[model samples]
Target: MSILDYRRQSVRTAAPRRLYQAALAALALAVFVLGTAASVDGCTPARDPRFVGTATCMTCHKGITASDLRDHFAGPHAAIDCETCHGPGLEHVRAGGRNGILIDNPGDDPFGATPDLCARCHADAVDGHAMTTHFTKGAASCNDCHNVHKPGGFVFASDPDRFLDNAGYVQLCGECHAQQTGEFLRSGHATKDAVTCGGCHDLHVPATFTAPPENNQLCQQCHASFFLGLDSPEAVDFHTGAFHPVDPAGSGASRCVTCHLPPQRRTNQDRGPHDHSLLTLRPAETNALIAQGMTPPPNSCAGILGCHDASVPGSGAPFNLDHPSDNTVLQRFFDQIGGIPEKVQ
Candidate 1:
């Protein structure tokens, strides 16, 4: 018989005694490791070294730049001690990091610490960061987004929005969200002053983050007479007897995005978030009308949403939605590109 046929015929049904001994040894090792882990609650056992201070750790880690040390000691996080993050580095210092606890960011913790470790200190900071797609699904760590242990440790923001990471926020967040950064930069928000990535986004929040006014309140935060658009006396204008109320709460919770900013094609991988353009075009309604060879109305968006008695075909462009000058600008731009400027893959 061939070698294969001979091997099949000569099968040994029972595993050897030595294999059993090896399995027992492995089980014992696992239990011992688990027991050691359980002794210290979750982190490493206290058998390591107790944390001394920055002075002790710095004595060995001489490579830490002077500016970094200054920032650490005199900066925003000066109140917090170093050992809480890097763990007790006493063993790390004595062992010279060859076989000891190596101090690194959360993303590269040698012992594989979870985001909850961060949540310990920042208990009230980022409400939903741990549950975000960036954390749970994408396996991203907090340090990946927020620069740690450095000068101006947090974001680089502008006036009014001191919490903004205006300086490094764009480039740091753009590392993964390139397509979003491009669209955002081209947006009027970027063209306008006093707005940045953190101006609208909570980095601690999930992939799609919206600030206070945009999330819970109306678009009037920017579009109202009080903010920037002097033309939006919407409170008085829409309250007229035969008014077309755009208020979501007043008119059956109809969102601004219901007509203006619906979902668009993917710009970044298969990410399913809608377009950040925030334009007033309903491509679905327009495409349907054009398929029937109907002309797009230049002004007067009254009939499509049934605010008017007469049937105006196509997505009737909303009337008095913005200033006449703003309408001109939007139309000119829409007709030029048909959509956003550059959508990266």
Candidate 2:
């Protein structure tokens, strides 16, 4: 046979093979695209039908009626069905009890006291809390801190931003951290009913119960009162260009914690045992000071509980209350944060 004729025959045979390879590649690509789409949209595969609704369960367990279901139906999780967290109820309702809530065994429930059930929906939010002392070591449950059935902190309050008490988050949180809450209650902020757990805390994103130690992101959200400069409420602002030259973003005194919530000695493995008094060690109550007409203390709040002493300096600080910031040395001693480090001793 001629070489040209042989080449023509080979080309004709390769065409179908190439087409077969192309078809296989196309099929594989289609499978991959669909698989990814399913995963991204969170589509679950078919499973045995088990849910029978909250009404069915109430029928058998007459005592556990709609009254028991009222609180759960009213909260933010209102849309979520009882079966979502409590497994399914067809068997339990038929059999009559807690058997349906279990995963493997007949009566071993995963949600009685642990954060496991809540984690199913709140994995990201509970990530930090899950690793914290309260959840892990303390063996505390989600229900202990949050009344999952009835969340009324915002709904029941007059200010909508307050309560942190009286069926509010503050009261709920205080239930566990009683001493800390009590200390917080005595603080000027509490006295004014200005803040709550949700105010400084993003419960969904805490590093721990008290993981975040008063950073700028959390502080700026509410206390922008000083962001306006001398025209601010106290006729003194905390931002730059005020006499205090504070780095609002700074971590220590340059920020708010230095003097206001000065660090307290750690107790019970607490990292940031904040004073919660929220006091400036000897705040310049100008009007009250004028009435008293006496020279201010050398360091308004100098000591371990405050910031820098009246004497030494660092980061252009060591602000002295004795030599308070007037127009003269304003920028240098600006926002004078007093007190030496609590560890100074």
Highest-scoring model, lDDT? 2
**CA displacement after TM-score superposition, residue 176 of candidate 1 (Å):** 1.7
Clash count for each candidate, listed in order shown: 8, 10
User: What pairs collide in candidate 2?
Assistant: 164-170, 164-171, 243-334, 244-334, 244-335, 302-339, 303-339, 307-338, 307-339, 308-338
The number of clashing residue pairs in model 1 is 8
Q: Quote model 1's TM-score.
A: 0.55
lDDT of 1: 0.45
Candidate 2, residues 20-122, lDDT tens digits: the string is 5445434434443444344422232212245455444334333332135455555667666555666654445433243223323312434344456667777
TM-score of 2: 0.53
- What is the per-residue lDDT of model 1 for residues 1-345, given as tens digits with 9 covering 90 to 100? 999877765554234443543454344344434544545433433334355445444443344311234445544566665667767655454443432345544646532254567677676454577657765666556566554554455432222322554346566777787766776666676666456676556656655456343232344445444434323334323322123333434442223433333334212212434444545453334444446776533221221232221232342434322234334443443343222112210
Q: Candidate 1: which pairs clash?
A: 155-165, 156-165, 156-166, 156-167, 157-166, 301-316, 301-317, 301-318
Q: What ranges in model 1 sit over 4 Å off?
A: 1-49, 64-70, 98-105, 110-112, 154-162, 165-167, 205-218, 230-244, 250-254, 258-260, 266-271, 282-345
